[model samples]
Target chain A: MKHIKGIFAVIAIVMLSAFTTVSSGYKIGDIATDFKLKSSDGTSVSLSDYKDAKGFIVIFTCNTCPYSVAYEDRIVALDKKYKGKGYPVIAIMPNNPDVQPQDNMEAMIQRAKSKGFTFPYLMDEGQKISPQYGATKTPEVYVLQKTSKGNQVKYIGAIDDNYQDASAVKSKYVENAVDALLSGQQIKEPQTRAIGCSIKL
Target chain B: MELYFYTMRIVCLLLLILTASCKNESRQNEKAVDLDYNEDFSTVPLEIYDFEGLKPFLKTNTDKTYVVNFWATWCAPCIKELPYFEQLNAAYSDKNVEVILVSLDFPKKYDSHLKPFIKKNNLKSKVVALDDNDSNTWIPAINPDWSGAIPATLIFNKEKRQFYEKTFTYEELETEIKQFLN
Candidate 1:
């Protein structure tokens, strides 16, 4: 009886440890809650600050993701192209520092400087802000438009069609969504499947 | 009678020790197996290429429903839904469904990271390295609307294609596959 009890105790310990590692999944059509983060230049920024703005482009990105790096120029271009039109871009780094230390604030600043990123690249400290947005991948794009209901998610998906070969791209998703919103028309494909490196939880 | 009791007690203690040793050895073996399969492709350089090579694989097979899942070693949601895909593969083995795991891991990590990960997971489905470097060309061809996110899955029959950008449970994946099958 004592031996059986001891064995059961060890098994229970292992099962309990396993439960602590499990993570909850994100869903679609979820509202992106507001979050505060430190910018690459050490300034604090918040999603609520952009509430009165025309629209917002919340891009979950990082320093080391090749897919995110590929869209660096495009992200910069999108900010420049749309900021005047009232849709400023906000880049958020969503990776856990314990797993991806390069995504920390100091490295974020260096990457932004080297890549000439004009927009604010903020660090999602404690990694709480991203999961709320249902952002699971780096380079995931979320287009938010102010509605009577609140800040509604207009579009979510890949930045474009091609990441490795630019010449063969058949569609420009981010640009198209922004264009549709700017034209005061509803975006036909508001949500799209984005492919990139998974954010470390 | 005292001597007999003492001998029996020693025998029981020896048996207990033997059983414990065997359990420890098996646990170690399991750990080694797991270690052998875990691949970390975070630092590898990406292989850059066009989509021309994937043309043959892109064509839909008439009778079978193809499930193309795009994932990487680093994505959390991708890892979360991996078991569902594996379960789908197991459940639909008799059906005309093929689950393809396309690793978007950097090309440099192919041998060391991606391959080991596939093997460690005991993945039974086909795995391919998407060597495309530029997202501009590849994303549009796959779908004009995709904003490159990991944990994305594409289900295609010759006549229809369905794409999902969120993580799935086994039931959800199986339901989508069934729809394609029907």
Candidate 2:
């Protein structure tokens, strides 16, 4: 009876520890897992494909998310501004069609064309890729830097400090990270809380 | 003396049993109260169709720090990080931290799924439905680079607004909120 009670106590402790560990999610310094997703143009784009680039921006966004839509121009601008600088932005639509049909491929194609997106707006079908990047929301920015070890995530957070009044913006997080990487400097703010629509699992 | 000892043991056992039963009863009562609260709030569907209507609901009080969280009923990461927002709201109750939960659940499932989920979680933040249909106009308004995703959260303090598109642990969330609050 004592042995049984001891086993039960041990099991409870193990379960509690397991729960605590599972609750604490991703962090900076984690290597970004590669994924192959189809772009709006139906071409497959993978993170590994951009291996030659100095850094990569993996943004989990979708067609229907207003927040994602809001960042459309900025994302395009980021792609245009940084792609040449070797920090190309890769946009991924992580919404599930079963829940949000409007976010499907047809809408994605239209949205990309309307926005004149220079970056690859990849469709994360089966919703498999977003979680791998620990992407929780649309417009979530993951800045990756290639080191000797591999593609290490440098900064993960918001684009800029202001969405409403851009003129009074204090911090340009995305730009700063890119600039730091370009100048061969370390990112000061390594991680940030991403704000946007929760990715439909 | 043996008889007295037996009586003492019996009395102790009865006290233990009585206390155990009382604790169980209190737990059951607490669960019942929670169920009643859930029932009261569960029926109200997270309104997800009125984008224009929601604009007015969005507190334009730029003086306060607005923490808007975009979550859906289905996202696991959203579920994981929601408690931190609740805690943040509670901690910063004295401050201008207004924690808003924007449900991104589909319009059709708002009533059946979203409301119950929110209620079950006992979310303490202000809940709203962002009913914007067209992503083009709305997304740019929110942020230019956003590729619509869920579990997104925005922290706005009139002069400064921060957009995050990633899941956060409590420490990270607190750090961001503290930055805004400070």
Candidate 3:
């Protein structure tokens, strides 16, 4: 009887904690759940598939958002710079095609082709994955660092300080975090904010 | 020495007169624009703002209530619910209520997209472009619970404050306004 009661208590605590994590969104240092979303190339990809990667730059971006458009080239550049360094960029379009026709898979393919994107631009089908990560807008970022337990969210928020003109940017938050992680140092600033188009549901 | 001082003073006086005339000309130009806006509200240019620039709109010292909404031209839900805000603005104007539409339109598209959309829709609410790129800072500053989503609204008066991150129908928006009014 005592053993059964202890097991029930443990189950209840685990369930409660799982519910809380889902509702609160992915915070810094939290273990992020791996998702197998369809890439723009018509093939499904998962974070766990990247065996040699030290970390992943999971970006919630889309085709129609002007803010996303602004960062498209920069995102490509980030992938070029960091993919070989073991932190490849994974772009996800989180908006529902029914609500945002412009963000449809066809558009994603066209954008990827035109931009010469080396990174995988995945579609978050049914809008299932973004809410779990708590992505509010297009171009939001979550830097996940690999650990023995799992991939932990190391940083969250915008790519850089300036979204208008990249050359004039004084602070590159994403680069700073990835570089710190590469050097096996703690991220100095793990979070930032940038104006972006809201994810259409 | 006397002649030199007298010449300098006259030059100074002429410079002052020239400066005042320029100032008056600019003021007249501004007044003319204001008059034009009052006569035809459609041509009013949307003002650009950053997070700090948008602070005054967040909090008010007056008895009047403000319904400030963050939106973009491309956001489907924002477009769908904008009519409710327009109706609320018209219905509650006499009650000292105001609506401020904050556009997060990409800066590059302000002329190509945002301006044309406003003209086409005939948006009556005071629309302003929020050009701040660092949203992680301001989104939470606007409301701690805000996930930086659009179609988000902040309704407030002198005493109470309410923030909503969901799309609202006409009835739902009206009810929220009424709650603040009462």
Candidate with top lDDT is 3
Quote each prediction's TM-score. 0.56, 0.52, 0.80
For model 1, how does the per-residue alpha-carbon lDDT over A119-157 read when each residue is reduced to its tens digit? 899988888877667566688888887666666787877
Candidate order by TM-score, highest to lowest? 3, 1, 2
Candidate lDDT scores, in order, read: 0.70, 0.69, 0.80
TM-score of chain B, per candidate? 0.71, 0.71, 0.75
* Ranking of models by DockQ: 3, 1, 2
Interface RMSD, one decimal, each candidate: 17.6, 18.7, 29.3
Candidate 2 per-residue lDDT over residues A1-201, each given as its tens digit: 555555556556554554444222235787777778889988998777875698798887788665576678888889999999899999888877766677889999999899899999888889877766766566788888887777788887778765533465577789999899899898887654433665565
Q: What lDDT tens digits, residue by residue, belong to model 1 across residues B22-48?
A: 211000000011224343644433333
Between candidates 2 and 3, name the one with more favorable TM-score: 3
Off by more than 4 A, model 2: A1-25, B1-182
Candidate 3 lDDT over residue span A32-69, tens digit each: 99999999898899999999999999999998776788
The true-versus-predicted C-alpha distance at residue B147 of model 3, in Å, is: 2.2
Worst 10 residues of 1 chain A by lDDT: A21-30
Comparing 1 and 2 by DockQ, which wins?
Answer: 1
Total clashing pairs for each candidate: 27, 36, 5
Off by over 4 Å in 3: A1-22, B1-43
